[model samples]
Target: MGVRRVAKGVGDLLIETLGEAVAEVILNLVACALLGCLALIACLCWSFSPRLTIAGAGLFSCLLAHGAWHTVRNPPKGRRRGLAALTAVAFTSTAMTALFLLLYATGCDCL
Candidate 1:
């Protein structure tokens, strides 16, 4: 029947979409992990210099905030507000950390 054929087509399309989404998520996780490892190495090597260390942390915070903001902007399905709130928390924390580091690096004894 036409109804059966349409249902089968819809199912197939859903399966294909799910498969692609899963694959994309996996690929993104792998890439992020690799880049994170590289950043860790660079940070470790740069630890001998205070300025460089601060720079690295600041750069990392900026990147994290950017990513979080992007996620907030594009929000995922079925829990958009919750996800946006979580991302906002993440962005705020990163911003605070970066600000603290900057102040400390600049010789503030506010600790």
Candidate 2:
């Protein structure tokens, strides 16, 4: 009876853990995709109007926030490296855009 209970407990643990693992993978992939899209949009919107650039970046930022929230809600799954690369690229693009706009607005008067 003792051996049977131990085996049954192990099986239950495996089932629950596998389900959580699968969920973790799905959530991570979704997050990765959102980050990738943000990076892509940021790259392409360099020459776009300030309003559109800001709007696009804002939308992606929200998506990223959502993904981040989920990641935090379920701790234990490791972060994917690709997400970091995507975020970095997006941030670079967004910063450059903002800098360019600021310079344009100020007429780069320092020059």
Candidate 3:
């Protein structure tokens, strides 16, 4: 019974550590994505033209595709997987939103 308790304790510790690591990774990804968005927005403001707007939208679409690829390739297999997946989805969605906004600002219709 004592050995079983020790094994369970170790397992719990491993799980906790994994959870922390995954959280840190997700945080880093989010930070990077936000920075990218900010830079894109700044560029758009400085160059308020249709070409610049289209470029911004293309950049965002690329970012979304990259994130989706990462999410699909690695996937979240356990407790950490769900958080990782969520992070990817969030990043992709934000990029798509930004792209749409850029398109709208440029008076471009998507059809």
Candidate maximizing TM-score: 3
For residue 31, give model 2's deviation from the true position in Å.
1.0
lDDT of 1 at 101: 46
**Taking the tens digit of each residue's C-alpha lDDT, what string does model 3 give over 1-111?**
999999999999999999999976665555556556767887776677877778877876676676677666754555545545565776768767667555443332221
lDDT of 1 by residue, 22-110 (tens): 97666555545545565688777687787887787797677677657756586566654654565577777766655644543333222
Task: Indicate whether candidate 1 or candidate 3 has the larger TM-score.
Answer: 3
Q: What's the CA error at residue 60 for candidate 1, in Å?
A: 23
Ranking by TM-score: 3, 2, 1
Backbone clashes in candidate 1 total: 0
1-111, model 2: which lDDT tens digit per residue?
Answer: 999999999999999999999976665555455555656776778766778888876888875665555444654457535665465556566656556444443332222
What candidate 2 gets wrong by more than 4 Å, as runs, is 47-111
Superposed Cα deviation of residue 104, candidate 1 (Å)? 33
List where candidate 3 sits over 4 angstroms from the true fold. Answer: 49-111
Q: Which is the better candidate, 2 or 3, if ranked by TM-score?
A: 3
RMSD (Cα, Å) for all candidates, in order, is: 15.3, 18.5, 14.9
- How badly does each model clash, as a count of residue pairs? 0, 0, 1
**Best-fitting candidate, measured by lDDT?**
3
What TM-score would candidate 2 get against the native?
0.42
lDDT of 3: 0.67
Quote the positional error of residue 23 for candidate 2 in Å. Answer: 1.6
